[model samples]
Target: MRIIKKLGNAFEFFKGTIAINLAVSILPLLFGGLLLFNYSVVSFGFAISLAVKEINSKKEYLFYFNNGLSKGALWFYSWCFNFILLISGIFIFNLINRLF
Candidate 1:
C-alpha cells in the first residue's frame, strides 16, 4: 500500500512531463524498438525537459524544495526512470525476438 502511494506521488510529480513520455515511446519505435544503445538520449531528454518545466514554474520548484526533494534529486529520478525503462523495454524486446 505504501509503495503504491509513493508511486502515485511520483507519477503526480511528473504529471506535465510529456516530452519524456514521447521520447521514450517514439524513439524506441523509431529505432526498431532497440533503444538500449541510445538510452542516454532518452535520459537526457527527460532531464532537460523536467528542468525546463520546473524552471518555468517557480512554485513547483519551491514546492518540491520545501517538501524535502532537491532539484538534483528530481532530475536524477527523471533520468533514471527513462533510462531504466528504455533498457528494460529494449531488453525484453530483444529477448522476445530471440525466443520467438
Candidate 2:
C-alpha cells in the first residue's frame, strides 16, 4: 500500500516526462552503454535535473517542494518509477522476440 502511494505520488509528478525518460533510458541500450549497465543511474540523474528544469515551470517545482517532498526524494521516486517501466519493457520485448 505504501509503495503504491509512493508510486502514485511520483507518477503524478512525472506523468508528463514518461516519454522523455524512456527515450533517455533506452539510449544506454542503443549506444552500447549497456555494457556497463548504468541505465537506471543515468536516468535517475537525468530525471533530477530534467524534472526540475525541463518538465515544467518554476511554480510547479515549488509546488512539489512545498508539498513535503524534498527535491531529491521526488526525483528518486520518479527515477524508480520510470526504471521499473523500462525494465518491464525490456522483459516484454525479449519475451516477444523469443515467442516469434
Candidate 3:
C-alpha cells in the first residue's frame, strides 16, 4: 500500500509532461527506428520529463517531499512505471500486427 501510494505520487509528478514525453516516445517509431531504439527513446523521454519538471516545479517537489518521497524515489518509480507501460503496449501492438 505504501509503495502504491508512492507510485501514485510519482505519477502525479510525471503527469504534467506526459504529452510531450509520449510524443518523444512515439516519433522514433513513426520514423521506422528499431525496437531497441524505440525503447531507448522511451527512457530518454522520461529523462526529459524529469529534467523539465525539476526545472519548472520546485514547489511541487516540496509537496511530494512532505509526503516522504524523495526526488530520487519519485524519478525511479515514475520511470519504472512508464517504461513498463510502454513495453507492454509495444508487445501488444506487435502481437496485433503479426496477427493482422
Candidate 4:
C-alpha cells in the first residue's frame, strides 16, 4: 500500500511538470508559426533549428525531455510555445489592420 501511494504521488508530480512545460512552450511555437505564415520560411526554419538546439543543449534542464521528465513532455512544451507565439502575432496583425 505504501508503495502504491508513492507511485501515485510520483505520477501526479510528473503530470504537473508536463503541464508547466507545455505552458512555457506555447509562445515560442506560436511565433514560429506566424513567421512561416508571413512567408518567412527562413525565419521559421531558423526558429525551429534554434529550438532544437536549445532542447538538445538544455535537455538536462527540461524535466520532460530528460529521464527526469520525458521526451513527450519536452516536445509538447516546445510545440505549444511556438504555436501560441505564431497565433499571437497573427492576432496582433489582424487587430492593427482593423484599427486602420
- Top lDDT hit: 3
Runs with alpha carbons beyond 4 Å of true place in candidate 1: 1-21, 24-40
RMSD of each: 4.1, 3.8, 2.1, 9.6
Q: Candidate 1: TM-score?
A: 0.59
TM-score of decoy 4: 0.42
Candidate 4 global CA lDDT score: 0.48
Query: How many clashing residue pairs are found in candidate 3?
Result: 0
Residue pairs with clashing backbones, model 3: none
Model 2's alpha-carbon lDDT is 0.62
**Per-candidate clashes, comma-separated:** 0, 0, 0, 19
RMSD of 1: 4.1
Which candidate model has the greater TM-score, 1 or 4? 1
Decide which is better by lDDT, 1 or 3. 3
| Candidate 4: tens digits of C-alpha lDDT, residues 1-100 | 7545534444443333333344444565577654434443224443454455465556344543233445444444444544555567679999999999
Every candidate's lDDT: 0.61, 0.62, 0.75, 0.48
Best by TM-score: 3
- What candidate 3 gets wrong by more than 4 Å, as runs, is 32-37
Residue 16 of candidate 2: its Cα lDDT? Answer: 56
